[model samples]
Target: MIKLISKTALLSVFVAFSMMKSQSVKEILNQEGSFRKDTIFSIKSDSKETYLPVTIIKGKEKGSVFTIVAGIHGYEYPPIVAVQELLNEIRPENIKGSLIIIPIANVESFQKRTPFINPLDGKNLNTAFPGSSNGTPTDQIAHLITKEIIPNSTIFLDIHGGDASEDLLPFVCYYNRKDIPENTKKAHDLSLKSGIQYVVSYSYTLTPTEPAKYAFKEATQQGITALSIEAGKLGTVQKDNVDLIKTAVYNMLENSGNSVKRKSKMVNQKSIVLLNQQDYIRVPEDGIFYSELKSGDKVKKNQILGYITDKFGNKKHDIVSQTNGIILYKVGTPPVNKGETLFCIGYNE
Candidate 1:
């Protein structure tokens, strides 16, 4: 004969099941000291799959939960190298808060040497945020980040750099959303505290009714303070750029009360913002791009930033600057495609 189950016991069982289902991140946070470095398998489809290789460094004592992610675009190597080195360098005992690091967010793209889009699903992983579990490999990875990693984070940093075909200046970006002024201001302050010299502020491209397409923006939308760092150029792992990213992360840790020294020097502390997403000059046609202008070059209004030529060496069109500003980033390689950003300019305000 079996004893009858009580309602209290049944409720306890239900609660335990729910926690087990949703508490993967909580379990990680509960762990102490030097801890787990593992892969989260997201999904498999068409005999292909995606994974999130993560490193969780829980402190000896409790504090804020900080998340750092790199390689959203695989060919951008500096942040990936920097985060990888950081994982090895940071000791669990030397902290006051938890740190989560994702060295290479786009592993498949990295393995395939693809630049911006995920080869498996042809989606830009950065743009697939707050993702759908029912979507492609890229979407699934984004889903894992949004669902699993983000819920545990109090602050999020998304690191990026120029891909193999572009030139980009070292900078940090924070969303200045009008609707969420407090979160926006917090992000702005963190960007200022970040060691990187250039600070870029941008608002949502769309109206407040639509969701943000960027990782940091989406995280900010979810009430998590977020910032983005862009450094290095033309894909190769430049040591200076890697060091720059490392210093920025170190600075972030210090700013967040992690008992770490800030490896940062004070910046100019001016308001520098991207003119607009529409300010990016697109390639006039599918052709080879020729540009004397690298990132960080001062330019004049109507200046010929670059030109494009067809495969047979026929002239296409002159890529001209629309405003007097600095070149924030531009296509550095010869290959170019129609509708791709030839360059973007930012002004000091």
Candidate 2:
């Protein structure tokens, strides 16, 4: 069943959307028929003040609340752009469930052109799950989603892509939370429904007692089915990648009976599941990295994946793959920092 948003919490949200009145959320959540509202939720702290752009849509019949969040890593443009485009494609009248869309979760980082972490508090918004109310800007934002949105949603998808310095292959991932078997099954089922062919999963490093670190992980911990969809590369918007997100999200929504009937059918792809955790090469020191291989390149055990050099172009280290696997992602730019990932490999064996 689709849960309703808290009436008290809805009033605290400041509405900045020109088309929506401030009372829309309260009115819709209290007794909803069919409504779609565009609004903004503000997060303020002593040092940071930013707002999230949100779109809430409900169908005539009540169903699951399917939430889609993009721009947790602000530099990733494709998913962000895809979500914005989705806003235009979907209408409330045709939907069967509620949709809580957060197009750009880190507006501050997006505006400042920051990558990986929030520019305001130097925090990775994805890592700050179940955040503190009095914490940093990113923390407050996470808290809002965890407290306000996650509780009201039945299914969630957090979309991401390669940051400015990284190139990544397209894949779909969900947390392997064995403690919650039923929820895990739902999440895994959603990953397979994603249009992406490469399906991967991450096991929880933390125990069931601990709150998860990632946004989708937190949703899983809270009993909501969630997934993380990755695409695009090197911070640039690729039309193919953008369309992939569009197709995957709409496909998932359509399957869950939350979206309008469409001619585009859901794809059943040949899923390549990486059986092991990602084997990564991290730099020992700041240097310039050179690699001819891109994401999806195959590598053999002990093969020279790349080389790192001192700033003056003298080789310092020859990066080698630890196992035979396919490269999932790599730092795309030249400048490398100590402990930064040079390459990430995934394997079935």
Candidate 3:
């Protein structure tokens, strides 16, 4: 009463079904395997095509997706180098999920050693987030990040260092939100996992321009855990400083999920949550600055932090602090202009 097909016929049918399923998986879902692919996200025009390199690494098994980005300012060489070296060190077989690393976010700025703004669009890439597709090059790149990268990521890690003229001690920042308690806790835990010296929390403050436009800000708002970590000083890259950032990143990757496993050697570090932006000490006039205080120095209210003198060394003005705090960052260069920021102080207690 039953019909049995020939072995050859049955084998052919099985092969056909297997091929169909493979094609469907390839077309519909993200491919599962361990491999490295270099992709270019392009913003096209009539004359040229500006492209940003995105490195994609997918592990054998599916888990959480973590994205690490650096080189937004170009001159922040420490994070850039650390991310670059990650390509060689990270083994896909040992990872449980995906890893996307954009070593140089601003190619134009990185090529020209420009600080802050992209030379092509004359825009700060950091501030131009959740960007416009039809806008400048920087904005387009930001758009790609918001649209293409952040959406696919479970964690958005923004790495930075002191620019060409900034000197700072190492620190980590996590967004704080009272309304979204879970997100706030995740972000805080991410910061603490980095094992950095200082940790700052950003809360909501009504202002003319909102902070919701930033890349990390938008990421956190969308229920993703985001962190911005910083180290190094000035534009020059030091091997030790680069290693410090690299270690912190490895720590994050190891603890994020089943990405990798290693011995836990993280030290217990103290953190301070910055409630407001009242600790900035800006220059009063154009002058040459001489400061005995550097980043990490503790100060009291009304204490003279530094002295600024005229070119001829005749007129001198003492730069004083308005609150008791620890110096977060100081100007690396001696020359300063009126209204320029000289130092930023963090809450002491």
Candidate 4:
């Protein structure tokens, strides 16, 4: 196939190749001072792109990198607002490390005030971590976060709160992976330093098909210190909750030796571990639910936490607690479907 090509044709081929390479490398963030960048991530199955708004604050002096993520559930507004405040309040020149903040992880859901799974893929972004490049929309976002963002961080914070349809007590969680002793201790320490009232040692009971795919879990699996903090309530952006979240970020930064004025002290906090399926109570059938219990309330085993009454006003099921623990979260809305989570309880072994 020895054919003579024109100089114009050769130039066109080179330009096309260069453009492809440039698109592949797509710069996420590159600056030494405070800046904001917006990116349209082309990771959706329906060929739609997700808007990832990022805030970067690079210190004048070189130090460790910390990444903070919020709005994984989209409808959780307090953590999202807290991240936005961080972008505005932090002085990059005064710090020693870089801070990368993603105020809204799921823009589509956030815009619509949707809860849980992505509308396009029907996948929970939290459970779709370590995702595939060719998978669903949520999966692709997870893959990008795991592959690109998490690897660049020495420590990562996955901040969250109750979605628009949920009500929950504030708590902070870190994965308890005994296999990695060094990172495990650091994660535990970070949890205590997070300025939250309750610290939960969370470990997944993985099956053959479902491994650990949560944001903090997958990040910690890669040897990065990670923690998850839950604050706010019922999809509302309360200032007190936002301030609590903001304190955690600054606390972690100070603990990690960032050039902050005050270091965070380890607060005396209650801790719990989730090791059984009974800890999570799910709706048994489709009905309108009425709950007498709220988050942080202590309940006894076999106690009736709430009752589900059908549309006709007949009680269909009695929501009961299977473990002697404190209520961690509950559905805020009365309408619920079968198998939907109604309440999460935290218990000690």
Superposed model 2: Cα runs more than 4 Å off: 1-30, 208-211, 266-276
Give all TM-scores, in the order shown.
0.86, 0.89, 0.84, 0.84
- Sorted on TM-score, best first, the list reads 2, 1, 3, 4
lDDT of 3 by residue, 156-231 (tens): 8899888988988888887776677877787777777777768777664424244456777767766688888888
Candidate 3 vs. true structure, TM-score: 0.84
In model 1, where do residues sit more than 4 Å from their true spots? 1-21, 32-39, 205-209, 260-278
* Predicted structure with the largest TM-score when compared to the true one: 2
- Between candidates 2 and 3, the one scoring higher on lDDT is 2
Clashing pairs in 2: none
lDDT of 1 by residue, 299-337 (tens): 998888878888888888888888888788888899988
Lowest summed lDDT across 10 adjacent residues in model 1 is found at: 12-21
lDDT of each: 0.78, 0.82, 0.76, 0.75
Model 2: C-alpha RMSD to truth? 6.2
Error of 2 at 190 (Å): 1.6
Instruction: Give candidate 4's TM-score.
Output: 0.84
> Ten-residue segment with the worst summed lDDT in candidate 3?
19-28
Candidates arranged by lDDT, highest first: 2, 1, 3, 4
Off by over 4 Å in 4: 1-46, 204-211, 263-278
- TM-score between model 2 and native: 0.89
